[model samples]
Target: MEMNLDSVKVVGFDADDTLWVNETYFRETEERFAELLESFETKNKIDQELFKVEMQNLDLYGYGVKGFILSMIECALQLSNHTISNDTLQEILDVGKKMIAHPVELLSGVEEVLQKLENKYRLIVLTKGDLLDQERKLEKSGLSKYFHHVEVLSEKKEENYQNLLEHLEIDVNEFLMVGNSLKSDVIPILNIGAKAVHVPFHTTWAHELVSKEKEKSTNGYLKLESIKDILDYLKH
Candidate 1:
């Protein structure tokens, strides 16, 4: 679908995989988690069980490393039939700690795009996760200077986007969101009468994935090969 770039005034960027390396750490942690449970179950089964527990605990823990750490521990207990050792459990917690301490690695062209667009548009950050964790990453990223506002929503539904736009006093038609997840970044923004740009990361968390049919049905958003490609249309 064609984008009305001329009408775009405010640009919202998603944190995590869109601007920096995020999912890679999660994937690595998952691998470590599976390895810790290999004695109790196969890697595949461990992965599935962990994901199941994570989904079940979504509302209880929301999202981010803390929840994921808890889910991994719960999954280990379930897979091992409560026989998992304390050492293995400690390893699982360490996995999450490492993830939290990991340095932010910005994606290719992230700084260049932000630098070019900083003066031309009112840039903001719109991401959902543990508020402290997200804020910490933003501070570490050194990209905070470019953003006029940063919001860490509990969820990224249409209403969430609508409410944020209203709170910020930004017209829906004049706001454009750019991010890596179609589910979190593109679809909701489109549904809320705003524009979005989808620049997919190589690895997506299972929860952030949208069905092929849903993706195909969604329209009115731009899909770019890289965040840098956005410049061609946004004209920063």
Candidate 2:
């Protein structure tokens, strides 16, 4: 891992898997969704189709549980050829409601790391999702007080990050982003001359996967087994 934390002033954390348990809930809900629509299609087929539906709807619904629920509904309709009953649709809606109401489970060592770095560097959340949903999670997390700012972005592209850095009055090299997804959290920030640390989550969304070749070419960023380990890299 090659890193120069000497210039880093603002340390931005990714909210989802980096700091808490998020993708697991989505995976569990997906399994339930597959079971619900088993009569229409096989679990494998349903899973693949749900991903396709999500990709197609990304532009329309953006990212979050609400968009996920809508994608599930669309997938159910298509797989059933529009024959899926209203009751099933209600069940899908309930799944989303339950997810939205799910408690915020912070990953291990999250607080300890935050406490160690809170005063040393400016901490901010750089996550992408529905604004309301993100805010709700932040409130439930009880980690909001440690952060200097919270940004719920619609997308995690180079331009979005550029704008954020500009607004914060920080140079690209002075900002470091920590997150789970390389495609979303690492690559874009790296592209804009910022530093990024990849803290891998066991279960990643398919959309967040990057090609091996692409990953190999994107050097200079640190890849740690856990978010807690970031303290070792920056604290030294």
Candidate 3:
């Protein structure tokens, strides 16, 4: 599906892997905890515990730093010899406050592409996470100016995307969804009849890397290697 650039009024972007480095920080924290718990449990066992806790918490807690914090606590308890108190749990949870990743480095030409397209499209950042944390990363990366609005939500389902477009009084066909995850970003937008662009990120979030791309839902979706490729497609 090709688009006339000027006709596209709203361009929604996903956070995390799409705009900056997200999963690496969580991976780093998990590795640190594995080392700390290595004596109590084998590395394989620790990884298994983390995966189980995280899977369980995704249902109870949804996704974000809070879920990650809970996963760490669960891992600690499952492998610990002594009883864990609330204070001990708080100690584990507090790590999230300092869990900010290194810096925001764009995937190749993300910033440049955003800069080029900002004037033509109504740029909106639709990301999910702790609001303050997302804001800090955006500010630190010097990427806040290009966007007109920033929305941080818990999930990016069909209802959420549809509501945003309805409120903006924009037709679904006139808007586009651009992001990394084929699950969260591509499939849902397409389900809503909006144009979806799949920009693959190198290191995706563990839960967000979907294995269902071949399904009929995303058959005609536009897939690009990176954000920069969107520019070339646009000029066509």
Give me the candidate number with maximum lDDT: 2
1-236: candidate 3 lDDT, tens digit per residue: 55444456788889788888788778777777777676688888887888888888876777777678878887788788556567656656666656754567666787998888888778889888777778888898788999988888778899998887888787887788888888888888888988878888777766776665444455657788878888875532
Q: Which pairs clash in model 2?
A: none
Which of the two candidates, 1 or 3, achieves a greater TM-score against the reference?
1
Give the 10-residue window scoring lowest on summed lDDT in candidate 1: 1-10
| Residue 62 in model 1: lDDT | 95
What ranking emerges by lDDT with the best candidate at the front? 2, 1, 3
CA-lDDT, candidates in order: 0.92, 0.93, 0.78
- From the highest TM-score down, the ranking of the candidates is 1, 2, 3
lDDT for residue 109 in candidate 2, whole number 0-100? 90
lDDT of 2 by residue, 3-49 (tens): 76888888999999998999999999999999999998999999999
Clashing residue pairs for model 3: none
After superposition, candidate 1 runs with Cα above 4 Å error: none
